[model samples]
Target: MKKETGLRWLFFFAGLMVLGLGAALTIKGQRFGVGSWDVLHIGLFERLGLSIGLWSIIMGLIVITIASIGLREFPKIGTFINMTFVGIFIDFFNWLISDSNTFSVQLIAFIIGVLLLAMGSGIYISAELGAGPRDSLMLLIVKKTHFSIAAARTIMEVVVAVAGYLLGGPLGIGTIVIAFALGPIIQVTLKYSGKLLEKSVKVESVAHGHG
Candidate 1:
């Protein structure tokens, strides 16, 4: 049991690190636009005196607070962990990479960012610690709309992207592409990652039984 729990923490942190790296890559990759969430981050950064990642943490806290109010319960420790680490990782990676002017390089970076974003989401969420603030809201919206994940995500993305744009965030072609692209990738990774986590747990249980 302790092993299983430890393994979960391992996956959880790995997911967050990958997720943050992906986010940072996207910003440096494309100057034109970013994903819905990044748009919000950039927007907040412009208005406030902070980095994009700091805005991410701030936004996470606000959203989590709202989620707690709606659910009538506090978030799990993993939730807070997710909020803090993902932001830190993003800032670290963002500072690590410089923006590129070449279109091909930009395209490659954006694609990889999207892929890592999905995979990281899958990894963290599979641990079942708790969803991020926006993810929490996504679930709530899904429930309100009769559990239509696709519909709920689309609506939420549109709203967030628009708000970010209004706040002087980057809103461009990449944003449109991200709006259409990320969902299917996240769905696929989430399904497989969950299976992987469960399989690892089963393997651990079997090994423990033998011991």
Candidate 2:
């Protein structure tokens, strides 16, 4: 049991690191990330003079509220971790890597960002601590509408992407790529990692019974 819990945490932290990396990449991609929410935030900030980071935090809280109401699930450790840590990391990366003045530098950052995002999201979901608030909302939509997870996720992404664009958030190549790719990336990562975790758990249980 202890070992299993420890492993889960390991994956969770790993996921966080990856997520941070992804944020950096999306920023570097010099394109709006593949979503409407980001586009909206960027648009709003650019046009209306809203603080992107602050608005993001507010949005996250609102999502959490919707998740609690719709899903009836309390905010778990993973939920809190994602809400708090992702913002901190986003700001940290924004400040630390703000000087992407050159094409080469921007390209490097974009690649690294995408890789990290894919890996982090994979790790976090595999931990199964509970889906992140945004994801929870996605799941709720899936259940209520009887839509496939992929379709639901894609619709949500598209809606956010469109809204973000209207709101004046960053919208570009990166956003499109992420919109199409994120679901597959997360699905593949979670599928394999989940198998590994299950095997580990079963092995531990057997060993414990023998002991």
Candidate 3:
């Protein structure tokens, strides 16, 4: 049991790191516009003179604070770990892949990044540790307004996308694609990843019993 719990934590952190890598890829893809929250981060980076990674961490902290104060929800350790390391990894990846050029390469990077983000989200969520800061806020909104999760998420994304666009963030086809496709992608990813995790746990349990 303890071994399984530790493995889950490892998977959770790995998912977060992959998410950060995906975010960085999307941001540095040059031609591809980023996801909604990333639009906000880019806008803030443009106006505030901080790195996008820094903005992500700051915004994540702000959202977590709101969840605690306004929604009376306490964040899990996984949340804080996600908030901290994701930004750092984003920065690292952006720096590492700073020189990617060409439209085809950029487009490929964007598509892969989006898929990676969905996969990472699914893997982390399956751990049942807790949500990322933005997701936590979305849940709070859903709770308070009695809105469906989809509706609440859409509202938040639209607001942020608009705000970010107004502030001169990149808004392009990729952004629109993400708005429409992300839910379905994450849903499919979670379903499969959940099954995979269940299989792994069962295998581990059987091995432990034999030992």
Candidate 4:
């Protein structure tokens, strides 16, 4: 059991790291993330004279509330961690940008920021601690609308991206790229990770005489 738990954690952290690296790469690519929601949020906060981190927390709470209403079975720990940690990391990256002396320096920071964000998300997700609020919401929509998960996610992201753009959020190349690519990326990542997890579980079960 201990070994299994440790392995789970290992996978979780690995996912997180990968997610962060992905984010960094997306930023470096000078393209929008697959979702690009964060870009909009950050831009909106900057315009409103509010701290982006604070805005993230606020937005996370709102999403969490929606998730609670929509998917009552979703775990709270994962939701909370996703919300809080995301805010912290965004803020940390924002600070890095502020302190940097040149656009080039800040660009590098932005890339790193994206990577960390992706990594953290990947790790937390692998932990299976709980689905992120947004993911929960996506699942809820899938259940309610009978739409495929991919379709539902794409629709939701599109709606959010449009709204964010209207609200003066960053809706640039990155946003466009993210909107088109995030679904596929997530599908691939989750599928690969799930297979690995299943194999690991089977091995454990066999050793325990349950398989």
Q: What is the TM-score of each candidate against the true structure?
A: 0.95, 0.84, 0.92, 0.73
Task: Name the best candidate (by TM-score).
Answer: 1
Candidate 3 structure quality by residue, lDDT tens digits, 5-81: 97688778878888888888888774779888888889998988889888889999999999877678689988888
Between prediction 2 and prediction 4, which has the larger lDDT? 2
Best by lDDT: 1
Candidate 1: residue pairs that collide: none
Model 3 TM-score, all chains together: 0.92
Q: Please report, in order, the local distance difference test score of every candidate based on alpha carbons.
A: 0.85, 0.72, 0.82, 0.61
Worst 10 residues of 2 by lDDT: 29-38
Q: How well is each residue in 21-112 modelled by candidate 4, as lDDT tens digits?
A: 44433334343332456665656775786776567668778888887877766455756766665556556544543343455654564555
Residue ranges of candidate 4 with Cα displaced over 4 Å = 17-34, 93-126, 200-211
In the range 1-211, model 1's lDDT, one tens digit per residue, is: 9989988998899999999999988887666578898998998898876899989999899999987887777888889889999999999999888878898888788888878887898889889888888777777777667856656767888899999999988888888777777777777888998898899999999999999
- Cα lDDT tens digits, model 2, 4-76, are 8987888777787668656755665564353445566557668767455555556778888997888776878
Candidate 4: worst-modelled 10 consecutive residues by lDDT: 25-34
* Descending-TM-score candidate ranking: 1, 3, 2, 4
True lDDT of residue 50, candidate 1: 89
Q: Model 3 off-target regions past 4 Å?
A: 146-148
